[model samples]
Target: MQVQKFGIEALDNMLGGGLRSGRPYIISGNSGTGKTVLALRFLYEGLKMGEKCLYIATDKPPHSTITSISDSFGWDLLSLNVMDAVPTPSLYSTVYPVRDVTAKGEIREISEMSKNVEKGELTMESIILKLELEYKEKFYHRVVVDSFTTLKRFGVEEERRNPVMAKFFRFFVEKGSTVVLTVEGNIQKIRPELILSSGAIHLKREVQDMEEKRKIAVLKMRGSFFDPIEREFIIDKNGISIRKVKSK
Candidate 1:
């Protein structure tokens, strides 16, 4: 497996070198835990190495998300193929149809329609196919899906969606791309059907005496060794930086 550097010495050392190639890893955390920042750093590092990077955002528009982060770093995120998976107003009804039992008979209808609801709007499998075709020989080493939680908002049950997540994971793994997916830990604990499909790492915020601190720890890695300690990390102008926590 090819190891990709994160541009942070302590973090690189913790993983024996860096993230392994062709593996799907989850970065779970709550809001303000710097999950998005971590993903950007991973892509930025890959871009520095001349590897193509793709960032798929389901929650916010790609431009807005990129603009907010690009000012903090020197990375040219616009140069890369950034896509917004949010559905347009016109295609919402056709893409997502909900079955409803009215007085007449059972009828399928689009419920709570909105341009922002992307639940059944985009397919991860289709996105991968498009990327493969666009970046044919360039070799895209890194791919980031901003948040899987947003993708699940389309009313698909966990049991039904697990297969989709699994297929998406396999698609990238087979293509030899290091994929990073952000997930909400609290939500995953409640509905864990997708947990079985990929390796997971939990990022938690520790509050002590009203002060908050962030920590990153590996919950599981499919077929490789990972540091067991919950390392402290920070998101600043440059991006995410991690340091090992001393053992007591």
Candidate 2:
């Protein structure tokens, strides 16, 4: 099976080269565990490989968040396609002119996109429709949803979240796009996405000796052998760098 790099070298090594390609994966962790950073790194790595990438910003405004990371890491996120489904008005646009799709689908002209910008907020269904359009146009190789938690709560009702999520995963699979969805919650508590996805990477933060420590573990990866240890990692200006494991 083919594999995709997670961008972090140690993580790539841990997963025995990289994650299996064209499968859905979740990054589960509590807040401040570097979930968004990790997801961005995944997309950044794909960008480096000249692959078309998409980022569906659901938590904060896509522009500010991407700009912050781009400036911090010296990455050109402007080149990447970003879908701004954020509830609030987005500050700026991305490479794809018709971002912030509050309307339904088929946003061809700038005037049309602007006309429907205030019609209604995008629902999960609308987002899926927009994704279908983007896939047809861009054929994105990698996709990242900053936090599925918000998307689920705001985009869909509780009764229909599961089915909607299932559809979300299926869309990526059918399109042959590797997806990384970030979710906020305890890693011990198994989430529905964890079960639906092909694999999961859990990020954990603990305070030890009056200092905070971050650890990442590959909970499960299908069709790949991985080092299932919780290795330490640090986030700096350049991005996440995992501690190298020593051979005994």
Candidate 3:
């Protein structure tokens, strides 16, 4: 089986070298636990390997929000294909063009998908359609969706979340892309995507010895052996790096 590296050396080792490729995985954590950073780092690894990568920015606007975050980390994200699916104000037209930040640092509008998008809203259905069109032309080796939490709140109706996400993952696998989706919450909060994912890496903030610490753990990985230990990590000038595994 092929594998995908997380780009964090110790984490790669914890997953027994790397995660299995061509499968969907979830990065679940509460706010301030480095979910977005970890997701971007995973894509950075793909970039280093010279693989085609895509980032779906659903939590915030891609132009300013994502670029600013990447800039702070000193990671040039120009080479990564980014789809701006962030919801716009209802005052805007629903028939807006689907745009992407191309490699040349320019926003290029793609084909129009609809004339009536329900108050110019970006919905789960439209996002899936855009992805389908994207895959038909060029395939991405790795794809990251910033946070499912925001998408859940605005993109889809609550009742249809499961089947829609299941379809999303199914299409993702069929395209042979290794996916990492960020979810804002804990492993205890059961979600449809978590169950649909091939594996899940959880991040959390814990207080030990009177200091708050960041930790990462692989809750479950199908068809693979993992360290099964919660490990300490830190985010600094170089982004997320494992410090040490928790003592058993």
Candidate 4:
């Protein structure tokens, strides 16, 4: 199967080249485990490849995240496309909402505005449509939806998230684009149905001998081989650096 570099060399090597193209992958991890940072690198690499990329910010402002990326990687993100999906403070009581800005520091054109959003219009399906429209219009090859689990409460019930999530993943694959979703929580806490139909990568951090150690593993991939060992990783001023585990 064809693949694209995951942008992290050690990770690419572990996954036997890189992520398979046009596939939906879930990156699962606990808070502060570098899930966001890895996602940033994924998009940053796509930018380097000259591929149009999109970042759907669900947990934080796109501009602030962009600034963090720029400050850390020295990569200016004023040209990347971003959708800030958080509802406005005043309008949280209603479905009406607005976005932050694009990489160029301009407001994004949302299909549904604060005044036009109807009652019970805050469904993941509806929000996805607006984003889907952008992907279709601009033909983004790489897309990331940060902490999609954040909105699992909006309109979809607990029992229905799987199918909705299944559709969400398929939507991108069907378009021949690879989409990455960051699931909030560790492997033990995730529902079995959530990973039933798509690829998954797990991240973890633990204290060892008075030092903090971070690790990553490929829990599942549809039709590819991924390194089985949990590799050690670190995040410094330069960004994430991965290394092979050594016997104690």
lDDT of each: 0.65, 0.79, 0.76, 0.71
| lDDT of candidate 4 over 99-191, digit per residue (tens) | 222322223333343335554335567666665555545677888888777755556777987778677777787888887888889777776
Q: TM-score for each prediction?
A: 0.77, 0.87, 0.86, 0.84
- C-alpha lDDT (0 to 100) for residue 49 of candidate 3: 92
Best candidate, TM-score: 2
Compared to the true structure, candidate 4 yields what TM-score? 0.84
Tens digit of lDDT per residue, candidate 1, span 56-160? Answer: 776665665666788777666645555456544322122212110111122111232333334446545445545555455456678888887676554456576
**On lDDT, who's better, 2 or 3?**
2
* TM-score comparison, 2 vs 4, better candidate: 2
User: Would you give me the overall lDDT of model 4?
Assistant: 0.71
Model 4: per-residue Cα lDDT at residue 35: 87
Question: What lDDT is obtained when candidate 2 is compared to the true structure?
Answer: 0.79
Please give, for residues 1-248, the per-residue lDDT of candidate 3 as tens digits. Answer: 98989788899988877879899999999888988888988988898899998888777766665565676788766687777666653122223332363222223222245553554466566677677766767889999988767766654667887888788778788888998889888666846767899888999999989999998898878898888888889988877789774366
TM-score of 1: 0.77
- The backbone clash count of each candidate, in order, is 0, 0, 1, 1
Ordered from best to worst lDDT, the candidate numbers read: 2, 3, 4, 1
Q: Can you list the residue pairs that collide in candidate 2?
A: none
* Predicted structure with the largest lDDT when compared to the true one: 2
User: Which prediction has more favorable TM-score, 1 or 3?
Assistant: 3
Give the poorly placed runs of model 2, Cα more than 4 Å off: 93-105, 108-120, 188-190, 246-248
Model 2: per-residue Cα lDDT over 7-26, one tens digit each: 78789988888878889999
